[model samples]
Structures are given as C-alpha cells and as structure tokens.
Target: MLRLLALRVLVATGFAVAPAIAADFPPRPVGQNQAGIGQDVNYRIEIAAGPSSLPTVVGPVSRIKDIATIQTARDNQLIGYGLVIGLQGSGDGLRNSPFTEQSIRAMLQNLGIAMEGGQARARNVAAVIVTATLPAFVQSGARIDVSVSSLGDATSLQGGTLVMTPLRAPDGDIYAVAQGPVFISGFSAQGQAETLTKGVPTAGRIPNGAIVERQIEARFNDDEVLTLQLRNPDFSTAIRVTDIINDYTASRFGNRTASEQDSRTILVKRPASVSAARFVAEIENLLVATDTPARVVVDERTGTIVIGQDVKIAQVAVSYGQLTVRITEQPQVVQPAPFSRGETATEPSTVIEADQSGGQVAMLDGPDLQTLVAGLNRIGVKPDGIIAILQGIKSAGALQAELVFQ
Candidate 1:
C-alpha cells in the first residue's frame, strides 16, 4: 500500500486545503522506526490535482463616492447651552460652579415657580453644553444624535437626564431640539484613601436624541454644474478622476461632460437630457484608482516609520551601530582594630565598562519599495536606526520623497 504525506497552510481569511502527496514506498509496520527502512530506496512523490490554494487579489480601485463629496451637501454644526439633572451627588458644586445654580433658578422661574432670594443649593444638577450636527437633506421631525459635555466642574454625568435645549446654528437660527437621558460609558468610585475612574465621565452622547425643527435649503436639483472635491488633493489623482468621468460619460451618454478645474476640484456639466440628481447618481458610482505623493512619515516618540509605495532611494551608503556604557558602585565598611580609638569608614568602589557593536557599511540603491526594505534589512538596522538613516539620506539628497516627522 502507498503512503500519503499531507501538509497544511493557514491564511488570514481562513485555512485553504492543500493537495495531497503520494509516495511509492509501502507503509511501515506498526512500532517500526524510520531507520529500519532502506536508505538506498528511492520514493516517487505525486500530488493529486485540485484547485489552486492562493488568496484572491484585490485591486486599488475605489468608488468615486468614497473619495469625493458634493460641495453643496455638507453638514451644519449646531450648539446650545443646557443642564443635566438626576445625579447621585456627583454633580457640580454651587460654590465652585455658580452657573449651575443660576441656571436652576432661571428654569424654576420659567416654570411659574418663584424661588426665594437665597441661592439655590443643590448637588444634583450640572450645567452642560449640547452639540449636534444637522445633516444635509434632513427635514423637520428627523432625529439625529447629540453630544453633551459638562460646562462646569461636575464629577460625572452618568445616569443624568438633559433638559430641553434648543440647538442653534452659526446663523442664529434654531435648527433642532435635544432632550434625552444622557448615556455615559464611564464610571467613578471613591473610598477614604483612593479613587478609580474609567473613560470620560463628564461627556456623554444620546443616539437619535435631537429632532430637527428647521431645514436648511440645499438647491441640489437646480444646479447647472456639479463640483466634486477630492478628500486628498493630488494632481495625478485629480487628472485620473477627470479622465475616468469623461470616459464614462462619453461611452454612456455619447458626450464628454467632465473637466479638471484644479488639482483638488473637478467640474462636471449636467446635460440637458439628464436631471442633476440622476447625473450625479450615475457618476458617483464609477470606480477610479487614486494616486498619492511618495512620503515617509516618522514618529520619534513611538519609533514608528511609514513609507509610501512610490518612495525611492538613490545610490547611497548607510552604517548604523549603538554604544552602551554601564557603571556600578559598591561600598565597603572599614573598622579600626580593637582598643585605642575605634572608628568606622565607608570606602566606595566603582567599576565602569563600555560596549560598541560593529557596524558595516552597506551600499543601498532602491528603485522600488521591496528593494529598499531589503537593503535596510541587510544593514541590520532597527526602526530607530532606520529613522536616522532615512533622515541622513534625505539630508544628502539621496531620498526622492518627502520626509515628515511627527
């Protein structure tokens, strides 16, 4: 009987089945060692035919909608002042945060309840600022998320309820109304000696907490031309986007309708035969490959290095090494012998040593990313050493990319 040898390979997505291998040699007897088999015998290996066990390749193309957005359709920011109540003695102190007390008195007066002349003293209320974003095309009565942050010295906002607050845009118009139970993911606990806290207890968010009260008019359908702004501005990417849009429009609509306005903007003329909304819906779904400038970013604090794909290094020589010095101190007590005048003293003994690793110069000339990494590895350079070497190469004008330090 023939024997079969199987091997398994693991991939990130999952495990793929490998073809089996057949050997011509017969199976060994039970409890027999491999050394018992004749060494002179030759075994033929065969693999059963099957599908390839390689992972699928993904291209760099992305939908135009992802890389660009309509200029007129953008979010509007809204802000308002509010109060959070129903706290378990973790609210702001009236003495330290006077705004909380004043807000409480004002709210009471508005509710037809008159407060005495004395100040309101309570540890269950906190002054807060409410913020929310009004999305484009949102109509009245649509709910959006809102965030609440303590405007006073409050310890926590957990299990607190925000009062009714009107959100106002920069144009001095109320856009939404937010009022809901504040949900915080953080908590705090204190004993006599120590306190423990997790996450941010002073800030919280409410999902679908704000209802839109007013709508900002966005004349999207009446536009004669559409402007697509690139998220990352690059000349090559802009040109590619223009070319792809024109190519698509010409092929489908029988006319070119796209032009490059600048390195960051592309203008597309809406055809009379097609509506503006339909034209944008069809163009934004097209796929285009993006391009970016070659750059190398280094973070010295974390010793991180990121190299772009188009980065290249000219012919250069690099050498890296580290020198370490160590010092140790030992003290010895000395005592005077017996009778006359006994005295004790301490003598300090010190030892010092230095170590320097050998560094060999490696010639590096990379026309691609893989070759550059291999050259750096051949020099036995670590991340820190690589950063220094890259900086040196940039200073020498041997690196053909932008070097950014963070």
Candidate 2:
C-alpha cells in the first residue's frame, strides 16, 4: 500500500510539471503557399549586355509591378485523366487501347446511360490527360489555362471538347475542374498521295481553361522579414539588388532594411508599422544595376555564333587559304600522221591549283564587337572557319570567355 501511494504521488507530480513545461514553448503558426495578385504590366530586364561593348540595357520601368517575387509562392501542377471527343476518325483504336474504351464506357454510365458493349469502338473518342498549373493565391472560380495531350493513339484533337475532368494535386485532392474545347496548335491532313502536318496536331492548349478551386496559403506576411529570390543567381546582381533596396529604403526610413543573404536571395527586415506587402513592392520597384559574365554561345547546327562584348583575345595570328582542283577531259586523237603506220590514241589531261595566302600575325584587340568582326574579316573566312579560329583561340589560352556549344 505504501509503494502504490508513492507511485500515485509521482504521477501527480508529472501532471503538475506538464502545464509549466507547455507554457514555455508556444505553437508555431502554419504558413500557406499562396500567390498574390501582382501588376499585369511586365517588368522584365531585357539584358543584352555581353553581346557587345554596349552597356547593360534595362527595360523600361513598368508601372505598378515588380520583377522579383517572394520565395515559396510558386505554382502547383494539377493533372487529370479525361476524354477528348469529336475527332475526324483519328482516335484510339478500341482493339489497341482498351483503357480508352473503358473510360468512355464509364463516362457514359455516369450520365445515367448504360451501354452493353464489351468495349467502346467509337472512332471519334480519344483518351487524354489534362494538366494545369495552380498559381499560388488563386482562389476558387478563377479560370486558368490548361494543356491536354493524347494518351492514346489519337491522330488529332482538333474540333473536340474535353469532358468534365477534375484536376487533382499531389495530395490526391481535387483542386480544380478543367473542361473546354481543345485548340490544337497544328493541323494534319492526309490523302492517298501524301500527308501534310504542321506542329503537333495531337497536343493542344485551352486559354483560361481550368477553374481554380483551392487556395494555397502563404506565410510571408506573418514573418517579420521577407526574402526576394532572384530568377538568375549572380553575386554581382545580388549585391546590386541589395544596395538598391538599402539605398531606397534608407532614404525613406533612415535605416537600411535589406541585406544580401547569398548570391540569389536578398533578405529584408520589415520596418515598424509598415505592411510586408508595401515593403516588398518598394524593394522590387527599385532598379538594380546588374553585371554580366563574358560568355560565347554557339549553335553549330544552325551556324549561329553569339559573342559577348567582354570577350577578349590575346595577340594571335590567323591565316586561311582555299585549294581548288580541276580535271579536264581533253582527249587528243592523233591520226596516222602522214600514214606512217601510227595507230590513233587518245590522251587525257588533269590540272590542279593551290592558292595559299601568306600567313600574317594580326593583333586582335576586342574592344568592341565591330572591331572584333573587322579583325576576323581580315582573315577572310566563312562562319565555320571563324568558329574554328575561335576554338583554336580558346585552346591556345588567348580567348578569355566561357565558350558554350549548343
């Protein structure tokens, strides 16, 4: 009896300490991932800095919109299985794709109709998968675009309407409903002689197609600080963004509120009595002077070469020459000259010419794109030859730029 009383006293002591311990730690507020409405005007930085000696050009200042966005306010993809109807006898064969027939039969049964067919053999029906992105902060009843692709052997989805399909997220919950007429980007027509096709006739898009039915709550407003994530990560660009925000915010608030987190993120502390949304808008509107790295991108398949303005080449020499070969069918028939018992014989001639210009050591000082082109033109070569020369320059450690081959 004494031991039991001791155990009961210990249990009572544990219960008494639980409330005190719980008071020390508070519950954390759950943050939702939601997108907010931004200005419709685009604030894009059309950077053509490295292409030439021209300074980095920033696009026109857009009104009421910021280029940078807060972290975690991203898009969510919702996908569904649906059926596209009204094809021109170019759909999945029931014998081949049993799933297509099964879908159609199930759809028909849902509409209070019963078909006693083993499998659907309709030539106008097709099985398709519908996909749409749910932007953060989108509420229910808002329309978004959807992309549909043929999941069966359907030739074209033109002039077809997608059946009511429920788009579900990764959590297996229905988020939005997508049902609209399919608009194919390309068309395909076939006859006995030949077939003509442009773009993808089986794939199509519907503008403002899927309706938003769920909300993604974000927690940017709850936190005392907000971070701006750059679309492209660069140390110089990140520093510039931070300085611009600090300069502007300090002028208004008399204190710097922004700090560079890393090469891609800028952390800004919300000021007293100012809303998080207002602070984010002010930071995004501030123009940043960005820098570019020297890079040379080339598409050999298209014979297109893009050289950066910062590209410099050490003193190098380039020499190019063309070689031509010719074969002439000049046959000479010599009759028995003066009938001296000589048989007629034919002689053939061949000619070859090699034109090699003397090599010259030309200095290449790439101060501007025009000067660079002029220096290369002095060698008088085609684009292919220019590519070879540039490759050689890079190999020789003369070209100071990152060469990217695409």
Candidate 3:
C-alpha cells in the first residue's frame, strides 16, 4: 500500500512538470512557407475525428481534391513494329536478331524493292517497336509522342530516323502513322581499355511524331449516365461528394443527379435538358468538402514521418534518450634494463566509455496531433526514436490512427 501511494505521487509530479516542458518545446514546421506578398489568413482546421477525445487544432487546413473531377478522359495505347534507318554502325545485327532482318526485308519489299533472291543488305537500319498513346477525343491528323526501342543489339541511334510505321490498336486496325527523327538521350563508345556511356541510345522518343489516322467516336451523350470513379476508396468521402454535387444542382435539374453507387464510384444521372458535358462542367466547378481520416505514413528508408492533424493518443508515458559508446586502443612498450640482455616487449591496452542522455518521462495528454508530437519532441525523441515510439503507441493502444509504413 505504501509503494503504490509513492508511485501515484511520482506520476502526478511527472504530469505537472511535463506540461511546462511541453509549453517550452518548439514545434518543427512540417511544411514550407512561400515568401510572397500576401496576408496570412487564419483558416479553420478541417480534420475529421472519430469517437475519441483527440485534441483539436486551430490553424490552417489542408485542401483535398476529388481526383475524378479534374480528369477529362482517358487515353488509348496504340502499338506497331517498324524499322529505323540512318544509324552509324549502331543498328541491330542481322545474324543475331533474325526478327530485325526479317522486318527490314518486309518493309523494303513493300516499298517496291524486290528482295526475292538477293540479300537486301541494310547494315545501317534497326528494327524497332513503335508505340504511342492516342489521347481521348483526338481527331484525325492530330500529332502525339511516340517511343522507339531497338528490337536487337543496336549500339547507338544518335541521328537515326523512324520509317513510316503504322500504329494499330488492340482491334488490329491502324489508328496512326509515326515517322520522325529519333531523339536519343544517351550514347555508347568503346576504347582500348575503357568505355564511357550516358543515356540510353537504343531507346529514344520523338515528340509530336505520330499522326492519328482514325478516331473513336464515343461521346458522352445525354442518353447515358456518366460515372465518377474515386482514385482512393473512402465511403465517407464518396457519400459527401454525392450529397454536395446533388445539393448544388438539385434546383436546376428538378431531381438528384448524383448518387453514391459504392465506395469507389459515383453515378450521376444525366439531366435530359442539360448535356452530359455541361453537367460535368458544373460538377467540376463546385468543391466538395472532404472528411479525410487520420493516418500516419512513414518512409523507413529516409526516416520521413508525416502525422495527420487528428491523430490521437491515449494516456501513456514515454521515456527515451540517446546512448553513445566509444572505444580507444592504447599500446605500451616495455624495455629491459640496459645491462640485462633481455628483449623488449609490447603490451596492448584499451579504454572504453559509455554515455547516456538524461532522458525524461512525460504523460501524454494526446487529444490532438500537436500536443502528442510536442510531448515526444520535448523528451529528445529523434527521427529514429519517433518511429519506434509511434509503433509502440499503436501497439499499446495509445495511437488511434492507422500506421502505414513505406
């Protein structure tokens, strides 16, 4: 009974002294501030909380974007195999890469050069895979970037040019034609005993190199409803997004236009009088307040720790400090008396020292992220120690947020 009373008194004293230290502890700014000529505004904290007594912050709030609202449409991939010409002894070897030689012969034959019997000797050419992304709603004659990669052992494509290559979609239909000067970002060279190389010369890109020859006409007409897909799955965010969109355009549409189909997607009923394009435009302009859950993400390699504002802590005490150990080697040589015919000898000696910091213990009244982190920092918690402390808190049921490690 006496021991228990003394332990209670010690804990009470720790609580009183800890808050004073916490008051003196300076918080390290986690974000960068821009140096601009503008007045600093007081923004309300928009953090979401669960059923707990987590501390609340009263400063600037972070804005979140609905990923689907900003995206217009998706792009399609078109691929084809063709040949590159005008290489300086960096072309694919015909003997080793048979497919390169076959492709070269086929393209040459199409250009009215009959290789029926004779060897179509083209050492300065290379077989390549041509690829491009056909952007959504791209019309015929529009240009896009294309990538050319050597299909064989080509040394360099410094000044090479891609031949007329037909890019086809999964349906085996030609959609675009690519032909441009290759922009190789690397080179290769061989010396007597050394070799120097930079960026990859075998694979290069041609900006605005392909011309679309066909178009896929799939317009978001008023007949069909448009679906909004969430980049990250969150039920609360999804429902809030649906309600905000409906509330904004409910009067104009005479009915709710948006509904949460699931956690990852939202279905918006196309207003008959308003076109789908117009409905999407209006939805994009409106901002939906986000209620993001608290989560702590840590990058172990770089020792990066990011804490959410609503991260709560339970009544727990943490004590931590730095430990240092040092060792030194010393040697002593012993010599015999000058008159005595004795050999000299050497002796080894060592000195070791251990030092530890005067770490303190503090009772964390974690109602919010600020006080919780401040208390830890006050006790000399370093980056490495912070990681361990957070893990311990989660294990001890003090931390009320998901701990994600990367």
Instruction: Give the top-scoring candidate (TM-score).
Output: 1
lDDT digits (tens) for residues 276-304 of candidate 2: 77777766666665556778898888888
Write one digit per residue (lDDT tens) for candidate 1, span 90-202. 99999999878988989989999999888766888999999988887788999999999998899999999999999876545688999999999999997899999999999
Deviation (Å) of 404 in candidate 1: 1.6
lDDT agreement with native, every candidate: 0.80, 0.70, 0.71
Give the per-residue lDDT digits (tens) of candidate 3, residues 1-406.
Answer: 0000001111342321111100111221223221222553222212222222323434432222445533223466777888899988778888888888777778767888877675555678888888888877688989999999987888888899998999876545688999989998888898899988998878999999999998765444523456577776767666666766677667777666676656666666677787777767777666654545779999989999999887889899887767899999999999999999999999899999999985678788679877887887777776888898889889998888999999
TM-score against native, each model:
0.79, 0.74, 0.65
Question: Which scores higher on lDDT, 1 or 2?
Answer: 1
Backbone-clash count (model 2): 5
- Better by TM-score, candidate 2 or 1: 1
